[model samples]
Target: MTSEVMIQSKFTKRFSKALMSLTLLSSLFSSTVHAHFQEIIPSSDIVESAEQRSLTLDLTFTHPMELGPVMDMAQPKVLDVITPEGRASLLGNLSLSSQSGEAKRYQASYQIKKPGDHIFYIEPAPYWEPSEGVMIVHHTKVVVDALNGKANWDALVGAPVEIEPLTRPYGLWTGNLFQGIVKKHGKPVPFAEVEVEWRNDGSVTVPFESYITQVFKADANGVFSYVMPKAGWWGFAALVEADEKMKNPEGNLVPVEEGGLIWVRTRDMK
Candidate 1:
């Protein structure tokens, strides 16, 4: 072949290979960069008499549905419980703890003093993610109903971002519709995006990346709904970019991703 033609052919081959590499790299990154959820999982969702009122809560930063590569969590900025009467700080009771293959998790125990729905919430300290070049802070919460109390299950705890449940946060059955309004700074965010996932307990397996989490968009009123497909704990995270920025570990200002998360449990009807 002519020199010019040979050179052109080689150039084309090199360019094609480079483009293929870029495409594969993009696909691999997209599959792994999933939604991180702040889990405020309790030992039990329902507290009966004072004997059963005490519950232990574990705070972990990770992908609950996938349950791997647990993100290191710093001490939370705020942790509190809101009852029918008022809100009280529970941070003093939190103790730094870790689990197998994970570090920097937290645990707390609280005793129910009255018949009311107790909402446990935490605003985790910002975590720097070098992969995304941003810091993430999730305002995560869960509810424990005491003696069938319905009060305070729907109360807002003034989180920077939060999911205000429209459906009763407890006593849900599988296939029941779960609805909540995505609020940021006490205002509705139109067309907010939410990620939903079920906490896996080693009985289930996901064959594809898409099966790890489900995404939905809120309506004009900042309300979204989903039906739980299984009998387990489900978490809904409404993510939004904060107006403020925080410095990352690299000492550079980066965008903050504020995730408003809430967890609820569903049981199958016999």
Candidate 2:
């Protein structure tokens, strides 16, 4: 062939090869992306027996974005529990701890009252769709049995309620006493008392009379605050008095009314 003819033929072959390679790479990447999005983790197979009393489920998710990019939209995954018979049992709403680092882990606890085979499904994405584009959905399932006895049940069902510290932004560190008030249902009743307790060496003591510096009334807002001389794990509870109509003829509050517990901790004071 002539020199120009040979050169044109070689250019055509090179272009064809490049096009074929691009097609193959596109097909392979599309298949891989589909598989990754459709993947589901393993499910639990523990059967429910009489011995099993409670069930606990822990879930974690990782996003491809950085912390600063999705900080506002970052939230905990939602967990939905459906009984074996196809009834919604427990729905937990959780959020990621502000203290969590880059991995972004959120946690929540659920208490199973009845014994049965339960199926849990979690969605690790936002509930509402954005106007811009649709977000990827990650879902998984698990089964649980509640035959593990009361202690095990409580371990899964009951957790220590987290209490946040109450402190001013900047304050002097002085050995001083503080007073707190408690109210319920927007009214202040006389019998509404608050008790402060603490624990040391696994022994709990009700030191309200000694350590409690003062007492105040819960205003119309039903709010209170107290300052502790020392820092430790402290518990507080309030006595919610019954309504006036429920009182007896002798002006004594009824006994059937429920009480309220107000628990908080002071991590630091400035």
Candidate 3:
């Protein structure tokens, strides 16, 4: 080959490699942002019989829309249950079980003895998100109705950040509108950003990548609403910065992204 042709070929190769690297980074960042959801899914959302008393919870940090790239979840900082009776610690019940290869997941099985609501909440270990240049702590929760429970789903679970459900939060049909108020420090966080997504069961195919996670903001009253588009589990996460800063693995103090997450399930009334 001619010297000029060889030079052009080398430059083309270098440019292609650089472009590929940039594309990968962009894709990774996009996936990382939407995957911040902290999931505490249960085996059942409604307990109706003595034979099905034990409720098993699946704990993980993942992108519900994509359903892959499951992030590693360390031991949770907070895991408890809130019932009409009162709040009690369920952290002792979480066993470090492996759901998939090398992905650390926590699972807890609780037997429902009462005929009310059981709210399972978790404050996961702060995850360091290098792409966003910050740490993320998603205080997540899910409610299970026991024998047609009451509307006690609006209780303040005392998370650093939380979502107080305005909807019934349980026993909902698809296409129902679910609403909640974002709260931090027991007060309203108006105009907060809430990211919404559904747990994909591999049957969904989004027309565009951006459609994987939907982002919306709460109103001035700290209230946000979303309609269930399909029959499955839906998650809402409201993000706010913590007043305090924590040191990352590199020993530099960084701001913490506090995400208040709530998971609710809907079904088609077939």
Candidate 4:
């Protein structure tokens, strides 16, 4: 073959190989499933002194482990704090957080006046996840201990689906085994599926895509447990399909992924 023809043939071969590699990488990444987590993280899980009485909560919808491609969060339909006293709406306190990208997030400030455990919860607007072909609704909550009063840490916020913490949900060190029962409509859901993820604050490097979200299931009576290996925020989401389907943006019926999420923090023993 002529030199020019030979060179052209070699270049074509190299180009074909590169194209194939790109296609393979794209397919591999597309197959990896990223778990969605609704975060309602508080500034302090426990308030001991007068200086710590005021607390701030950050609300966002995103892949907590992957950290991004944050989904836009609309104004929540309901935001409340439940305590032994009663449920009080905090929707008015929520304000838009200044974040990059078009996706919106929220924040709220609350003063811990009384001494008790306060469960702050949110019923976010349904998010349409086209990749999953479903609308996602995650009702998420976090507990804050006020003035050293730790009573009723397991109080339910009356979410559609909820996790009643078997553990205290706060004041813990790393490697602590956190346990909770998944409930739907105030009843235990036998053998429910739960996805857990650590809120990546750019500290821990994820080894693999699968490591981003840990998957496990609840046994009979819908109880689940996990020992957090890192000192940071961890979210447990128990997901179940609702009995009724909802219309998608295209006016087609799609399944609703109803999730009950709870957030807890672990600190390194000093």
Candidate 5:
């Protein structure tokens, strides 16, 4: 080969290696930095009339701010609704409803029979995150009030790791403050890290990566608080390393991220 052609071939090889390195770095940074939320969003937070008794909840595991890049979610180990009366399993109500090329999602249709707070919670199966090398299990919950029945909104679904809301968690103004206690096995977890994100509805623009997810730490008593400034569904996830490691898909032991998440919505007071 000519000397000029040899030089061009070497340059192209070097450029390709450099580009591959950049791509790998970018993927690693995104996987580790971006927040993952297990969402359980109800059709309505407050049910008033007869027509609104039927509620639909969309369940997915994804980056809430980015609104996409969803992860495949296996059927949850537990799915139930806790009310003033009692707790009832809703796993049979779940149906596969995933979009093309996206992760497996679930949609549940629930009929409100009584007047009270309906607390729906889920314990999703462990998702193996290859980028972070950890298994993620988020126990998520959302509350929907039926016919002005607001009792027992703070009821617990008895998760291994959970966020016990100090606030009512529903029917609030945009500027209202939300407080919750991070709990593990019904006990408080001091200084637990909590990540918060706003579910983008294709209207807001994220100016920077930092703006995508907001984070905070629980106090000495495992209590954290934040004020909602936007009128949409906000998800708060309290995350901590699990006491026990789980086997990965490769049959190797890996750390587990036990997260307790809760969802609430606010309005602009129109």
Candidate 6:
């Protein structure tokens, strides 16, 4: 063969080999990416009591990664409740709120009125790929008591509730700086609103301009805490605004006087 033809043949062989190597690398990378995308963690379920006699539903999702900033807002999770009669009730209409950091959790609550056995479940959807086929639904049974009466004024009031401070010594604001729990009638009231106000020394109380208020929902065990800001003599009170649409176990709207105040004091600020 001519030297010129030999050199051309060698160059062609080298070029073909390089192209094949690049193709193989691309395929391997595509497969790795696909595998990562397919991985998904299972979800969790929670059942809560909205009132002494009513039940609330909570559902949470576990994702493989941080779920990207955009999808974080979407908070894709499906929730449903099966009535005692075996009727499937869709939970999509309920308001969904999420908190994400070290852990991501979604919460929604609906009042269950009838005194019977009800099933709550988390249905799987396409936001995150589930390892199991179609994600088996996980659920819990909740019981409502028919004899419980509407929440009383004393049972809905709170006192001496210490809240966590907002600003740390380093001037960093931790999201849930509040850290204290309030209870009424020996049961933890989750997601109840607490208001704080600074009062003058005189019997006549002047509300401080820098008042703090927060709405906190209790955990599954009906417990919560809030950080108290710079501590001093401050009037604190716990209140749960009555929901006219919500009926107590006795089928009556929970009642509380509007603008009601349950006074207590926080002495030491830490």
Write down the TM-score of every candidate: 0.88, 0.29, 0.93, 0.89, 0.98, 0.26
- Runs with alpha carbons beyond 4 Å of true place in candidate 3: 1-5, 99-101, 149-151
lDDT of each: 0.90, 0.37, 0.89, 0.91, 0.93, 0.35
Model 2 bad stretches (over 4 Å): 1-52, 62-73, 76-78, 84-86, 89-98, 126-134, 145-270
Q: In terms of TM-score, which candidate is stronger, 4 or 6?
A: 4
Q: Mark the 10 consecutive residues where model 2 has the least summed lDDT.
A: 153-162
Select the stronger candidate by lDDT from 1 and 6: 1
**Clashing residue pairs, backbone N/CA/C < 3 A, model 4:** none
Clash pairs (backbone) in predicted model 5: none
Give candidate 3's error at residue 132 in angstroms.
0.2
The clash count of every prediction, one per candidate, is 0, 9, 0, 0, 0, 20
Question: Looking at model 4, which ten-residue stretch has the lowest summed lDDT?
Answer: 25-34
Residue range 1-270, candidate 5, lDDT tens digits: 999999999999999999999999999988899989999999899999988989988999999899778889999998999998889999999998886776799999999998999999999999999989999999999999899874888888899899998999988899999999999999999999999999999899899999999988999999999999999999999999999999999999999999999999999987
| Candidate 1 similarity to native, TM-score | 0.88
Candidate order by decreasing lDDT: 5, 4, 1, 3, 2, 6
User: Among these predicted structures, which one has the highest TM-score?
Assistant: 5
Give stretches of model 1 more than 4 Å off. 1-32, 99-101
Candidates 1 and 4, the one with greater TM-score: 4
- lDDT score for residue 94 of model 4: 90
The alpha-carbon deviation from the true structure for residue 65 of candidate 4, after best TM-score superposition, in angstroms, is 1.1
Return the TM-score for candidate 3, rounded to 2 decimals.
0.93
Task: State in Å the error of residue 18, model 6.
Answer: 24
